[model samples]
Target: MNEITSHQCNLNIWAHLPDKVWNRVANIYELMPGWIGYIDGIPHWFGQEEDDVYIQASVEPSGLSFYAQMNQSDWDSWIGAFKLEATKVLGFEVGEPEDGFE
Candidate 1:
């Protein structure tokens, strides 16, 4: 059976951005061509219904909180894009996603 794995982190840099910027960053995945909306608010890709991959994020006082369950390739792609988007939109250097959760 497929097991759901998770990773969480504090995106401290995100705390400094304005609401508009934050919204833009948060919606990056949603704007992508393959993203599909789910009531659960977890991030996922279209045509991936048969896979167990999933992701979710939220704004926190320190920064942003991100969680995802996916394979290595998916995690690398998704997390890389997320960092890139955050850096581009926020106009700052985003840090690497620390392995595991705090």
Candidate 2:
């Protein structure tokens, strides 16, 4: 969707992590390249950055959160790639995170 357009769908990707992993989660995003500064103060990854879709990511206590506005197919590909990367960087299985879209 265009930046100016209101998001019709909301997507959330969340996972509970270990205590140690919690502290490092924020750094992962910080060190990663190609992300929009913020969308209303939320760290964001523009669709243009990877695939024509927008994604927002943040870290919570023992959890990782990702918000986005995009179609199912795009979300699947995007999140799938994220899991793989997280597994490599975090050194864990990085199993499928819980997801919701509407």
User: lDDT: which candidate is best?
Assistant: 1
Overall lDDT per candidate, in order of appearance = 0.61, 0.55
Error of 1 at 10 (Å): 2.9
Report model 1's TM-score to 2 decimal places. Answer: 0.63
**Cα lDDT tens digits for candidate 2, 1-102:** 324322322212234546566456555565554565665666776654345567776555334556666666666666666666666777766653343221
Instruction: Provide the lowest-lDDT 10-residue window in model 1.
Output: 93-102
